[model samples]
Target: MAFAENIKKIFTLPDLRNRILITIGILILIRVFAHIPLPGVDLENLKEFFAKNQIFGLLNMFSGGAMQNFSIIMMGVGPYITASIVMTLLPHVIPQLDALSKEGEAGQRKINQYTRFLTVPLAAFQALAMIKLLSAGGISGQQIITGDFTGGNLIIALITITAGTMLLMWLGEIISENGIGNGVSLIITLGIVAGIPSQVRNTLAVITGEGGVDTGQLLSFVFFA
Candidate 1:
């Protein structure tokens, strides 16, 4: 009873409750976006395409299926990651960028602005490449546009996906300002953590179908004992 009361006391703190609830709400929104698709491919075809590309599979795993579906948030933090990678690797090769990097808060803000700019091209190119790759892998023949990969549809898709990622980036920033935790990190972490239970359930169902540990133990006893 005392242990229960202590736990209750912790949750009863108003600030903590609000933070916890805010996190939950943000987490729910991220999950909802991850499942939404960008149109053009079926789930089975997308799965096969992912199976062949380890790099993309890893990306999908991190994004919680957003990449496979070409979801609004499909680019996920990939653009941000690419930007960080550039900053990390360039410090040794680029003297000017490196010098600016050491300017404390001012320097960091500059880098962030650069990253946001860099993210645009990175997101667009990656999205276009992914669309082509998915189609080549037999995932879709849908016009990048509705009727064809015409100039219009291509541009539209480019805009749609790019805006999607930018929106996610903006939302993450908002969360950081008005809610709690680093928005981007929390969003990605939530994506992965949110999938864990479903993964476990799927694995468990397979195990149960095969009679799981009980069957394994019986066979072991028959052969060794």
Candidate 2:
């Protein structure tokens, strides 16, 4: 079969094989990071809250469940993506950036550097928002962060989350340089894919009435639909 031959040929080519392997290795590393939770999180309460809140459930799916886990990479490539989007739009509005954009690769590199710089504050801000939301504890009145989530712990969390975003950004660049395809997009795609199984299971539970679809909740769902 042509498909089979092509698959075989991919492995037979050393460069292609190495690139594929490198991509896989990086993806595995990202998944591992997704499971490594940050300190001070009450994961049980967090998980329960996510289970009850559809909005955060969707966010968790996009985050590869890192948000639910309160992982270091909980922000994933989100801040970087926001930064890239901002940078892309800025060149259109700012004359200086517009002129720089015409410098070709050099200009693009500068824009990318700016994007990376922007990601830091965005990551920290998002981390703060997440902490605030989780600490609020939803309808269950159960805080996702146990005890006082302030002072040194809060500072450490912000730095750790921001650093995690930077680490992912660096890894994505590495993949782009050494592996195949657009690394950041690949990471985001893989994250979405990784959450599919749990999403399906949750959907099934809802359909089977195991999700306890109350009258108000059902009405809200229908209204949204």
After superposing all C-alphas onto the true structure, candidate 2 shows an RMSD in angstroms of 3.4
Query: TM-score of predicted model 1?
Result: 0.72
Query: Which regions of candidate 1 are displaced past 4 Å?
Result: 1-7, 47-58, 138-147, 196-225
What TM-score fits each model?
0.72, 0.89
Clash total of candidate 2: 0
Query: What are the lDDT scores of the predictions, listed in order?
Result: 0.68, 0.83
Q: Clashing residue pairs in candidate 2, if any?
A: none
Worst 10 residues of 2 by lDDT: 216-225
Q: By lDDT, who's the top model here?
A: 2
lDDT for 113 in candidate 1 is 87
The most accurate candidate by TM-score is 2
**Per-residue alpha-carbon lDDT of candidate 1 for residues 1-225, written as tens digits (9 for 90 to 100):** 999998798689888667767767877887788888765546665654553444444556577777766677888877877887887778689888889889989988888888888888988998888766655543444332222443777788888888877877877776777667688888778666654443333334435655454343233233322
